[model samples]
Target: MSQSSQFKAMEDYFQSLLNEGAPEPSRAEPAPQVPVPAVVAKPTLEKPRQAELEQLLAKVPVTKPTVAAPVQAAKPAVPRTPAAPPPVVWQNIQTEREFQALFFSVAGITFGVPLTELGGIHQLGKLNTLFGKPAWFAGVMTQREQQLNVVDTGRWIMPEQDATPDYQYLIMLGDSAWGLACHELMGTEWLSRDQIKWRDKAGKRPWLAGMVKDKMCALLHVRELLTLLKQGVNIDGV
Candidate 1:
């Protein structure tokens, strides 16, 4: 009806339309519905399988530090056997009671006598030849104020034996001297008492004691040998 009333009515109607266009107090749309999935439990392992895994771990070998052994030295070899010694040879000289017979070779014949009976062996020195004596009597020589008579035993023993001018030595038997012209002096050998095998004395001459071992060896009584020389019977020849 009037202008004011019309304006008021129009305002009222716009207000009512705005209020109707506005959503009514929105109930919060329930949050979009989300479903939570249930958790699935894992299966437990067997005791045997766990034990086998532990055994495999134990079986795995571990490395260790090593030590070296000491070395030994070689020994030298020894000799198995020893050498032997040589043998000994001895002389047959036994007793002092038995005399040693020294031999000399004269004109290829050997003659020996006991060294105990020998006075001495001397080198031929200055001698005096006596006249009117037997050819077997070599000469008379002077030595130490003693008159020495020499006899050539070889010539005396065998009348056919020749005289050797190179007589160099004079062998003195007791107080008498005899020329023993020998080629060489043989070595001495011991003659035991048992070695002298004596023969019958009754059949023997005064110059010989007895036969010794088949030969007529004079039992040289030095005095008697000299006596036979003085008599010129050629003691060696007799």
Candidate 2:
């Protein structure tokens, strides 16, 4: 069939249906919209209440930053002063019977004589000149009811001192009448035998036995002096 014809038929068919009073097609109803539940927002906190809460929180005590105290170094202890040293004590010891000696000077030369060798020490009381004697002999002095023949020790050692005759002491020679005129009598002193320098042989003067280093004096040998006296070297200037 031709397209115009087919359209005419359909139009006639619809017209017939209208004439026949055909029921109109029912339209489907749209489904009812579901009601959405509204979201209820919580109320915002008030500014004043927030401020009060902040003030209460501020009132609470907070721990402050603690700074450790500086450590102090201990001071050094002061050292005590040492005590003074003990005083020195000198000891005098001797094994043998020999002991201290006495010293005197003549012509500025010191001479030491053993204390055991001395008979006595006397004062130069009224020195009476004896004739027919050498210039070395000073004079005579009476001591202890005995005549002591005093020799000028200074002049004997040094002939230059003969004119002045400066005699002060009469040192007796071992219970003999012979005595030495000394200007001074020095005190006694303890000396060890090792301190003296011994002589091997007799020198020009037998009386000088050794040298005493302690007092820088010549040590007199009493034995040699007695031997020389026995030889009558200076007896009456013979």
Candidate 3:
């Protein structure tokens, strides 16, 4: 064979192999499977059982039963009523005899009075002049539905000293009233009847009840003061 013809046949064979290898691949077919149906089972019913009957029969003839008599109940006892308590007796309460005393300051001199007879201490009120009276009997004033005869105690006790019109206070006795014009009301204190010490010899004046401690305290006789006021007597008398 000639070298060129052999080369041409080899080239033709190679071209046929390339054309067949370049072609598109075909898809594979799926396998077919047979379908199976689901199985269904039917329910079974059971029959009911029968119950047996029992019979009761006596071999001998039956007789009626005898009943016993009923019993009587016991009687209840009567209850007695309770007695009432005794009445309570109450005793009367007795009060102690209490006395109040006052301290008055006038011109540096100090004096005190038993407040038992003293009605009250108050500020100077409007004065009502009383004629035919001493200078010491300043005037009159109405207080608590009673006539209060105003007396300048400072001037009456110490005539040497003059009375300052601004200084004044009321001294109220049991059912009797008087004004003790003083420089100041120095408050009050509580004292017992035993606190008083009587003088060895009675004083010339009955108005002085007694003395207390070192103080020359004079218990202004309330009854005497009221009596003197009623009689329109000069209280300035010793």
Candidates in order have lDDT scores of: 0.62, 0.72, 0.63
Number of colliding residue pairs in model 2: 0
Tens digits of lDDT, candidate 3, 103-198: 777666676677556667767787798778866777877766667777776676666666656776665555546666677777887766666664
**TM-score, model 1 to reference:** 0.48
CA lDDT of 194 in candidate 2?
83
Expressed as tens digits, the lDDT of each residue in 1-238 for candidate 1 is 9999999999999998889967788798778868888788888779999899999999999879777777777687886787666643322222355777766665666565667657777666665778888777777777788777777667866767676566666766754555444456666777665665543332323444332353334334454455677677774435
Clashing pairs in 2: none
Top candidate on lDDT is 2
Question: Candidate 1: worst 10 consecutive residues by lDDT?
Answer: 87-96
Q: Taking the candidates one at a time, how many backbone clashes does each contain?
A: 0, 0, 2
Which has the greatest TM-score? 2
Q: How do all models score by TM-score?
A: 0.48, 0.54, 0.49
| Angstrom error at residue 78, model 2 | 99
Error of 2 at 201 (Å): 1.0
* 88 Cα displacement, candidate 2 (Å): 47
Cα miss at 8, model 1 (Å)? Answer: 99
